[model samples]
Target: MKYSAIITDIEGTTSRISFVTQVLFPYAARQLPAFMQQHASEPAVAEQLAACRNLMQQPDASLDAIIAQLQQWIAEDKKATPLKALQGMVWQQGYQNGAFTGHVYQDVFDALSRWQQQGIKLYVYSSGSVQAQQLLFKYSDFGDMTPLFSGYFDTRIGAKREMSSYAAILQHLQLPPKQVLFLSDVVAELDAAAPLGIGTMQLIRDGQVAGSHTIAHNFNQVEELIA
Candidate 1:
């Protein structure tokens, strides 16, 4: 196998940034207050609310305060784990209600399916919670592509820009870094993975900026890079 595994980013890699920024984030922001009010007593929602409070160093923060804090995080595009978890919970409702299907680029859709059939283990690493990542593929416009992925990862694994995070993922996958390819649109993320010996590719969907990693305009180009 040219590569034993392929790990990919979601936004701007396999999917468009507009889907996350314009759709998912706004949906969560719109429904958060109601979602929190209805689910606050539930253990899962409560746990994340508590985590948000702790992250803000406000142990006694009220439910309203927590809601406000989350809205702020959404606006800032912060990658706070607790915020991501809550957004996933909110998005679960949206997906179940047929609000919108997840968007995956055509090139990515074809490449991911082809790679999976070729026995390259596929994984997702995104700021989105694992639940959110699964939801995207599970309800993708292409329909239920979740089975293509071998696993999912989020900030709980570690921050994407840190070399140690990629090292941790390599350890979990139990694969040599050189045999795993990591694809992302962010240069810093590619930089982090590259030093760990992971093959790195930057998606140049929004035109190119010079970077240390190999660049691909789309997943078809990435296939060429890997081959």
Candidate 2:
């Protein structure tokens, strides 16, 4: 009821974790090598490849090694910046080729639309790349919902569990942290944001609310709290 900006996490919050783990992740993993090989010479791909190398601390790593490293990261769902960026690039191809559309819960789309109409600014903070975040909403299962979001933040901003990341987001939004409501299924992420004075709400889609910051079983419940 007091927030001006709403920042939400994607996986396990607005979308099902199964969708990320089962659909998106597997698709990206399967396409990574081929995508990298095809686009290795492209500027964006080349930059991300360099980033992967930097992250790996192997300045002269071969392309084959990098691909293997990326596959391993995907298996672990590591939130490393380079891995996320590369995944976004690979996902872009899938989205464009009509392989799959982004998944969003029905209630999420309704809540986002209603909130947007009420002049609340919506933003996404996900482990996924900002480009991936945009593409997800832009090509969502319910239809294009990107227009509902004002901005997207990814790991490049900072780790989700670090207080500094919430501080940075508050600064970027030019709003007091208290004026922002941060939603996620992860208690640690809510804990980090709360220390920065951001209101925290934990999505409990998996029915485990014992350790949550504030439990909301669905977007409708979240909407009521915001109201």
Q: Judged by lDDT, which candidate is best?
A: 1
Over the full model, what C-alpha lDDT does candidate 2 score relative to the true structure?
Answer: 0.90
lDDT of each: 0.94, 0.90
Tell me how many residue pairs clash in candidate 1.
Answer: 0
True lDDT of residue 38, candidate 2: 89
Query: What are the per-residue Cα lDDT tens digits for candidate 1 across 50-104?
Result: 8998999999999999999999999999999999999999999999999999999
Model 1 off-target regions past 4 Å?
none
Would you estimate the TM-scores of all the predictions? 0.98, 0.97
List clashing residue pairs in candidate 1: none
Once fitted onto the true fold, the runs of candidate 2 whose alpha carbons sit more than 4 angstroms away are none
lDDT of 2 by residue, 70-132 (tens): 999999988888888888888888888899899899999999999898899999999999999
